[model samples]
Target: MFLRRLLPLSRRLFSSNSSNDPASIIAELNKEMESVFGEPPSSTHPNSIDNNVMAAQDSQSVSPKIVENDYGLTHVGSKGEAQMVDVSPKENTKRVAVATCKVILGRKVFDLVSANQMAKGNVLSVAKIAGINGAKQTSNLIPLCHNIKLTHVRVDLSLNRNDCSVEIEGEAASTGKTGVEMEAMTAVSVAGLTVYDMCKAASKDIQITDVRLEHKSGGKSGDWSREE
Candidate 1:
């Protein structure tokens, strides 16, 4: 490719023979090239090609920006592979997270659960237990979650007559290098699932929705909360 592009310019420069000065010849050659090719191609010479390749390799050598947040999937290695985060270097600190979810049970199932008439037993009590257990076992459930000792776990369930749903709130606290966001979320999720399992007999149309972290505190990123 280099030879093909250079052949025309070489013929035109030597044919002119107007000046034997190497500097002037080189400058004319460059002007002719720009007129014919508009821009220099990367394959102009072996050294230019090597320089471009080196520049690309240098860019790849730089560590990529990795953002850890609710909108991004983290826990990645240098080679873009999945890997667990290492928090061993971090200092232990108190962390707290709150998560919430809602289980839509319809009017009939909601009333039954509210009145403690479900055949599977008291829905709220069993779900609360399940939520606490789930918070403790968060590391086992999530592949990349750290197994930190939880200081406390609380699960609250309330009947929402307006929506005919059970609102579940889970709170988890820990003194560890990593935050307990996943644990709190796991608690709310498990509680919602237990609510469905206990009341599925009454209505299979039950839905679990709005599972999300409401607030998190005491991390390197500081604190965060949902906007209303």
Candidate 2:
């Protein structure tokens, strides 16, 4: 790229070499300088990069972007570092969250599970218990999450014959500075894992999928629900 630009200027300068005046030669050299390194920028030019080292130092000195509260990443600090949020100053409010997941069992495995004929005993009952326990121990499982007292937690499982899957739903409620969204999500995830563990012997192809939060309410962000 530099050679391409320099060649054009060199051709023009050589063509004008017939004018042997000292002032004319100096003018040609200045033009070459301007062509090689772009015209000098004004000191106040907002986007100037004339002083590359100074420009880079200015970029490095720029403050980090502030994260606003429209569901921004609260776990990150102002210095662009990962950190847990401090909920000490926030008001304690009643919060509720619901999460769900699906476990796909093949036709034969689904039949066996539905009939409670698996060697693992009652799959749904055990998964439900696991989900409840998971909700209670969510803080231990996830990093940077606050351990808040939960008011209630419930796990429900339903068999979807049409899809040959078991739908697991978990709801968590708490009256604290933080919401129970993680707890609810953890509950659904653990319950799905429990289902997979108990049924893996019968079918290795069993899949757990579509784990998501379906609803949440009673927080500074207000309420939100997934559109059906």
Candidate 3:
């Protein structure tokens, strides 16, 4: 809870050679922490704890008992209560995320969308516009989501005549402190829902499934892509 930052020693903490003398490493860390926040309990003997044990303890404790809360569930408090994470300290980074969803149109619905003969109008076009709007209004739709200005949002919907299905892909880009995975996913989901709404008259049982984040890039953590 305190602002006693020791970011200067972040690299040292993780890079320390535990194979040579893990106990010594933890002891050194304990000494440094003691200087900042006082000593540990007399019952906690040095030999009783090691790197992994200390890490678990540090991850769970979050108050005067802890000098540095390295990592944990950011959206939850130490007491397991819900709370928003403070992302202000993190540097702004260009963030991009891509998500995909599949809408399996029944025979009648597929014909309507593929032929652009839906009674509600151009099903794919309306879904595209709805997806863009969904990306922009992500913070409003989801609880505890930050309001971020997206630099770009692209929603693409393609119909596959072979399988009578539509594939929806949404990509959201933002130059901010947080990734846009949620926005991308929400866009795809909303677009798929839009398709269902527009074409439900043709087939009420049209299936929408397999919505997932396909890729994410930027931010402090760097780039990541799904294996499949």
Worst 10 residues of 3 by lDDT: 1-10
Q: What is the lDDT of residue 169 in candidate 2?
A: 97
Q: Candidate 1 has what TM-score?
A: 0.72
lDDT of 1 by residue, 1-228 (tens): 556777877887788767678888899878767866687765578698789999999888864653223334558665566789989898888999999999999989988988999999999999999999999999999998989999999999999999999999999999989999999999999999999999999999999999999999997888999998
Rank the models by TM-score, top first.
Answer: 2, 1, 3
What's the CA RMSD for each of the models?
Answer: 9.6, 8.2, 21.9
Q: Where does model 3 exceed 4 Å of error?
A: 1-71
Residue 161, candidate 1: Cα error in Å is 0.1
Q: Estimate the TM-score of every prediction.
A: 0.72, 0.74, 0.69
By lDDT, the better pick of 1 and 3 is: 1
Per-residue lDDT of candidate 2, residues 1-228 (tens digit): 767876776677677657677677678777777877888876686645558768888778864463333346888666656788998998989999999999999899899999999898899999999999999999898988898999999999989999999999999999989999999999999999999998999999999999999999987899999999
**Candidate 3 collision pairs:** none
Question: Candidate 3: lDDT over CA atoms?
Answer: 0.87
Best by the TM-score measure: 2
The total number of steric clashes, by the backbone 3 Å criterion, in model 3 comes to 0
lDDT value, candidate 1, whole model: 0.91
Scored by lDDT, the top model is: 1
